[model samples]
Target: MVEIRGGAATSLDDMVFEFLEYGEESSPESSFSSGDGCYDDDRDEERSFDVEESKAFWDEQMKLLQGTFYRTNSVESKIRQATKEVLKDAAYSSQCGCGRLRVEAGGGCRSCLRREVCNRLMNLGYDCAICKSKWRSSSSIPSGEHTYLEVVHRSNEKRGELRVVIELNFRAEFEMARASEEYNRLIGNLPEIFVGKTERLRGLIKILCSAAKRCMKEKNMHLGPWRKHKYMQAKWLGTCERSAPAPLPVGNAARPAKSKASMLTFDLSEAIPIPGLRRTAVEVGVI
Candidate 1:
């Protein structure tokens, strides 16, 4: 029996029972709440890490691109300057030997432009030629062909010949219709016209391809086989055909034979004369 003391004395067993009941009721809820808090913290931490990693990746890419653009040698600069001059003159030229208008400010015929550039470079005493690279489809990539200009220079036998590639639409080559902002920004830094050595071009290709892979991974998109590094390298670095352009004809010999009635000034009446039909104005009544 329990003895009553002071006010009302409770049994020791009741005190222990009450404490146990309280613990049992609160333990699961408290533990569950703690677990949820820890999970949230971990998730937030992971997201922050991902964001930081993405930023670092783009920063590194930008640095590489800027470095590539800034590094240039005297040979590259001389050729680049000459190429620019040729492009300017071609853009303002009346027409090509084929009687077709030259390229305008924004756009024009790239084939003609290439021929003109090759000719101009050749006339300037550079060993220039139009190169075409074609590859058969393989297990990893599809068959494709590319045409561009190259200037080969051999300073000495020991140094071998250095190939300088000239690409007119260099920036467009890497553009994607569906790409992230970071990826597009990276491409925007590329020059519209690229004039560089094979080594420099190879480095640029590696940098761009790596950036493209990262972008696709971040967006959870599949990269196309054609856009792969191997494919891009194959365009310029693979087996190719080099063709020297014919020099532009001199004086009137360059123009082709023109017929009496050219397409631009052809008259149907003159070509087909109807026996009883005359050039007379006849009024037609509307029905």
Candidate 2:
């Protein structure tokens, strides 16, 4: 079951969202662990992260999800992105407009014309006259502003359906580094590293979402190191969340061809795994 909090969403089918990175070079920088404690460490962070580090991390994550379909080319992806943008712009302007930039065409409010533009783009989807018109900005953030991205696969229309919202943890980058430490410690011994750690990764994800929410809402982007902050491990993030269901032990099945569009991905790919043909431990000739 894939999950995210906050408001942004995207969907694709045939493949689950392995992870998605928004900016350039998305394969090498993402540091991730499954249920493992890859970077758990005893030390506190003392260094500042590079501005590009986040981009690198996302790129790496996207690499992990390559060859999968997100239905991005479809109008759906455009719609979803537009929806989030509209909401974000509205929120930014309503909340004092730090994110709002220059106002060239939209309308009156010189104060938050930048925000108004975003709202307009979001409301209009890809039909935004600015994008097609290639309207120039007097002051675009030279360095791209930090943005949130989500990865998803198509949901079965046969089944009901779901909508996801994800919020990032401001401290996730540090936690990832720590998880890396744990991963290093247990290189030769996963069982030991994972002892009592079935859901460490999930807990970490929750913490990240909380941090991102706080940062976005306060309109301040201040962040903390990941390793120092401890996450609560005793609870599930919420019942509304759903993971990609699958065969008990193995991971997800391979995805179908992808064309970059919005889609819904399901974990249990068999649609209905055949009972008799189901591979069991004995079927592997292990028994």
Candidate 3:
């Protein structure tokens, strides 16, 4: 009969004979020959190597994916923060003394008076008051003083280039001009002809807004070497339907075409500045 040594059958042939002869021998121990053991060792070593390689590759991939995700999140956060700050500054700059005065004909601050004049001008179809106003200043308003306008840039992986968006905020520079004693004295003399300080402030803001829009249009048109990739571009997508030519009436009778109400879009990427003012200090973020 075969005997188990160290919990293993010493010989496979002996173990089988012993089981057949005794008819009730104990179960044989699981053991391999030296050659078979060496073969298995090689296989296990190879499998272990493969597992390690797979683990390392997957770890690297995970790190890369995580890095990309975090970077995108970081960029978005910065854009949002910058946008909030710019909007706040713009709103603050746009604030005027109009709200402090009661709305009365010939009885309020110049700021209030301007709004009334603007309404009258709008009704009169003189939308280009900034260009035509007698009180419009000729001096170039230096930026970064009463206004903070900037362009923030982020890399577009898909486009393989930088994408730019603008942010603009301006304070009323004409406040002092309106509050000056000379201006007050002049208004007193020609109250009917002179627009208030508020109107003057509005005109300046309009000029700046116009300049900003022009800058954006120019940038989009040029796109600076990345135009081929369509990487940096700006557009003004209004919320009004495109005006189409009206069809001629079949008979002499015809209905008047409904006027399309256009709304301005406040998208920084497609910001439209008021048409004529030139901005001097436009900050751009580093990539």
Question: Which candidate wins on TM-score?
Answer: 1
The residue-by-residue lDDT of candidate 3 on 1-287, one tens digit each, is 11111102122222111111222111001122345455576667766765566445434433432332222233333433433333233233222333343332222344333333333333433321211001112233211111111122335566332221211111122122323232233222211221112222233233333322333342333212211111111111111111112222222224456755446634433456666656576697999
Error of 3 at 170 (Å): 37
Which stretch of 10 consecutive residues in model 1 shows the poorest summed lDDT?
23-32
Candidate 2 global TM-score: 0.23
In candidate 3, clashing pairs total 10
Return whichever of 2 and 3 wins on lDDT: 2
Please give, for residues 1-287, the per-residue lDDT of candidate 1 as tens digits.
11211101322222111111111111000111234454586667667777777878888988887767666666776777787777767666666655665544422667777888899888899988888888899999999999888988888569787888998777788998888999999987776778888887898999998888777777778999989999999898888888887665442466677867568768677789978877877797999
Over the stretch 1-287, how does candidate 2's per-residue lDDT look in tens digits?
A: 24433211222211122122222221112222233534444211211243256444434433332322221233334434443445344433322233223232222233333334333543453222111001112232121112222223245677332222222222223232223322232221111101011123354444343433333323333333222222121122222222222222111123345655333654353556766665444443555
What are the root-mean-square deviations of the candidates from the true structure over C-alphas?
27.4, 26.5, 39.9
Q: Is candidate 1 or candidate 3 better by TM-score?
A: 1
Ordered list by TM-score, greatest first = 1, 2, 3
Residue 270 in model 2: lDDT: 58
Q: Where does model 3 exceed 4 Å of error?
A: 1-39, 72-75, 78-161, 164-287
